[model samples]
Target: MLIAFNKPYGVLCQFTDESTGPARPTLATFIDVPGVYPAGRLDLDSEGLLLLTDDGRLQARIADPRYKAPKTYLVQVEGEPDEDALAALRRGVRLKDGMTLPAQVERIEAPDLWPRNPPVRFRKSVPDCWLKLILREGRNRQVRRMTAAVGHPTLRLVRWRIGDWTLEGIAPGEWREVPV
Candidate 1:
């Protein structure tokens, strides 16, 4: 079975948290279906579409970077992005790890999204803007790092779409079965 889950902020992508200290919220808290596992990770601080599946082949197809499934994110950055910054992102930016694949990025109006539980900090002095970024590869904290490299640190990051699946009707902490 394939599932689309809207992961909330501060929740681990995994079913369990093995680290010491007070247990952080995990996928198991919201997902009760047996045998289903997350296809890819959405960082604890980031929010949005997460796919899960019980089938190993389907899971690998969705999660593996080799398949190059496009993932889209709505990012709120600290400063307004100029054409140079946007162009850089479009051409692919050099990250500490390596050069990223070219991404489709554009300035966009703030998207209508659910309010974050704790909320993003309001900085009166620095201006902020929204961006729509589509990437073919999934790298750890890539969105955050990409924006930061372009002089616009990300204030908030939300994965809006993954391949053909989206968080359209799936509210935070909610999941629904989808056709394979």
Candidate 2:
């Protein structure tokens, strides 16, 4: 079975016993079904669609770098992205690991977004806007780092879609099982 979970902000993706950190609940507490693990991770600071499955192969197909599934995000940044910054993102910025694959990105209006708890720091001096970023690879804090690499720093990040799956219908912290 395949599951699409709407993970809320500040939730851990894994079911680890790492008590050292603030005990944020993970998928294990909510989705009790055995033999399944998350396909990929949405960091504790971000919120949105997460896929889980009982089959390792199915999970890998979605998470692994080889398949290059499109993952879309709604990013709110500190300043307007200049043409050159957009070009850098399009061309793929060089990271410590290597250059990220080019991304499809465009600015968009803030679409009646739900407010996040313990909201992002407000910067009245610097203006902010929303951008839709679609990348085909999974990297740690890649979206945030990418935006920061350019002048515009990411103030808020939310995953809206991963391939055909989405955050639609599901509320924060909800999960449902579907056939593979």
lDDT of each: 0.95, 0.88
Q: Give the local distance difference test score of model 1.
A: 0.95
The top-ranked prediction according to lDDT is: 1
Which has the greatest TM-score? 1
- Model 2, 1-180: lDDT tens digits are 899998888888998658785677777767788888999999988998899998899999999989999999999999999789888999998888899999999989996667788788887888999999999998999999999888788888989898988877777788877656
Query: How many angstroms is residue 146 displaced in model 2 relative to the true structure, after the best TM-score fit?
Result: 0.6
What TM-score would every model get versus the actual structure?
Answer: 0.98, 0.94
Number of colliding residue pairs in model 2? 0
Clashes of each: 0, 0
TM-score, structure 2 vs. true: 0.94
Candidate 2 global CA lDDT score: 0.88
Model 1 worst lDDT window (10 residues): 162-171
